[model samples]
Target: METFLKLFENPSVLKFTKLGLWILLIVLIIGFLRKLLKKRIEDTSVRYKAQKGVEIIGYFLIILMIFMAITLDDIKDYTIIIGLFTAGITFTLQELILSIAGSFYIFFVRVYKPGDRIEINNIKGDVIDIDSIYTTLMEMGEWVSSDNYSGRIVKISNAFVFKGPIKNYSMDFPFVWDELNILVTYDSDITLAKDLILAEANELLSEYSQKSKTKWQEMVERYYIENATIEPTIAVNLTDNWIALNLRYITDYKLRRDTRNKLFSNIEKTIRSTKGKVTLASTTLQLLKIPELEVQLKNKL
Candidate 1:
C-alpha cells in the first residue's frame, strides 16, 4: 500500500496518467462527434468530410498531448529544434507530403469526387475512393472500347493532380460529345446516305441531347463557357474511295458504349433497309495490266 501510494505521488507517474486520461477523453469525444455527424448528415460526401475533419482534430489533440508531455517546462528551448527537425523530415518525404496536400486540395476545391469519371496521366477510370495519399479508380478504356471498364482497380497517387491534367468527365458537365463516321461507296446516293445517318442519330440521341443542353445551360451559368449546339449534327466528306458521313452528338459520359451501340444498330438497320442506295464501301485490288517485265525476265534467264 505504501509503495503504491508513493508511485502515485511521483510527478512523472502522475503526468503520464493524466496524459493517458486526456487521450482517452479526446478519443471518446471524437468518436461521439463522428457518430453524431454520421447520423445527422445523409449525404455521403458531406459525411466523409465531417469524418475527416474529426480525424484531423483528433490527430492534433494527440500531438498536443505528446508535445505537452515532452516539453513540460522547456517548451521555448525545444520549439526551434523540433521545428527544424520536422522541416527536414518533411523535405525527405516531399512526394508523400504533396500527395496529402493534393488530397486536401481535391476535397476543398472539388476537383473530382467519388463516382466522377476522370482521366489523369492518360489513365481513364471511375473514381471509387479518395484517401489522404491516393485515389482509387475502377479502370476503364484499356483494351476496351468506348470508355468501358477493363475490370481492373487502380490506385493512383494524388500528387498526379499537380503533375498533369485531370480530365473529369462527369464533373459539372456529365455529358461528352462523341462522333461516329459511316463510309459508303461513292456510287451510292451521297445525299441519301447523309440524310439517313442524320435521321438515325437524331432518333437515337435526341433525348440525350435535350438533357445535355439543360445541364450545359447550368454549367454556363456557373462557369465561363460558350454556348454550344447540343443537337445532333451531320457532316459529309468525300474520301478517295468512299463518302464519310460523320454524326456528332452528346451523351452521358458513363453510357458512351451503350449509346454508340444503339446509334450503330439504328444506322445499320437504316442502311440495310436502303438496299443498294447506301452500300458500304470496301477496298479492292484490281490488276491494271499484268506486269510487262515478265517476258523480259524470262529471256534474261
Candidate 2:
C-alpha cells in the first residue's frame, strides 16, 4: 500500500479531516438541540418529530462533508470520474436508489408515518420503524386476521411506496366504513330482516362511534380542520330470492374483524328467533311440469 500511504501524505487528507471535524460539530449541535427539546416537551409525538428533524439534518451534513472531502487536491481532479462512477451505480443499484428515494417521498409526503397501521402491497401491519431503504412492520394477518398485527416482524422495501397500493389506518380520518352483508330468503319478513341488521350494527358499533367521534372532534379543533359529519348507517337491498342486509359502520382499522364478529353474532341470534321465517338464500330446483304431467296421465288412464 505505497499508493495509499502517498495519498495521505498530501495536503488533501488534511482538508478531509477538517470536513470530518465540521460534521462532528454538527452532530454535537444536534445532540444539544435534542436535549433542549426533551426538557420542555411531554408529548411523545412532538419528541419524535424533533428527533426526526435532527436525524435528517445529520444525514445532509454527513453527505455534504463526504462530498467536500472528495473535492480536495488530487481528489478534486477526479470529480468527473466520480460522476461517472455514481452514474454506473445508479444503473447497477437501481433498487437501492429507488428505495432511498421512496423513503424520502414517504417522509416528505407524510403518506403514513411511524406508528400508523398500514397495508402495503398485501402485507398489513403497524409501521414500527422507517429506515433509508426499508420500512419495518409489526407483522399482521396471522392469528387475528383482517389488518391486525399478529406479533411478528417484517421488513419491506420502501420502494413499495411507489409501486403498490398503500393503505393508511392512522390518518386524520382513521376510522373505516365497513359492512357485513347478510342475505335472507324471499319468504323472510322484509321489515324484520332490515331491523335485525340495523339493530345489531347499532348495538355493537354505537359506543365505538361515539368515542371515535369525540376524539376526532378534539383532534379537528386542535389542528384547525373542517368538521365532518360522522355517523354510522346501515342499508338494505332486495332480490326475488333474497334480501341483502348490509350492516355498515365505522370501526378501528385494526378491529374490523372484532366488529364483524359482534355484528355476525347479533344478526345470527336475531335471525334464529325467526327460524323457518328467515333463512339464508339457497339454490332450488323445481320440476312442476313433470309432476303435473304425471297426474294428468294417471287421470286419463
Each candidate structure's TM-score, on Cα atoms with residue i matched to residue i, is: 0.77, 0.69
lDDT score for candidate 2 against the true structure: 0.79
Best by TM-score: 1
Per-residue lDDT tens digits for candidate 1, residues 1-301, read: 9999899897767877989999999989988998999999999888987887886678577878878786775557658877997799789999998887788789789999889999998898999888778999999978987677899999999999999999999988899999888888878888888888888788878888888888999998998888999988888888888888888889988788889899888888888898788888878888788666644334554
Given candidate 2, what's the lDDT at residue 192? 77
Q: Write the per-residue lDDT of candidate 2 for residues 1-301, one digit (tens) a residue.
A: 9998788787757676677788888889888887888897889888878876877777777877776677544656767887898899889999998987888888999888889988897888888888778999998887884765688899999999889789887777667778788888877787777777777777777877897898788878889788764555657787776677776688887678887888788888888888777786666888765544444444554
Clashing pairs in 1: none
How well does candidate 2 score on lDDT at residue 216? 83
lDDT of 1: 0.86
- At residue 145, what lDDT does model 1 achieve? 74
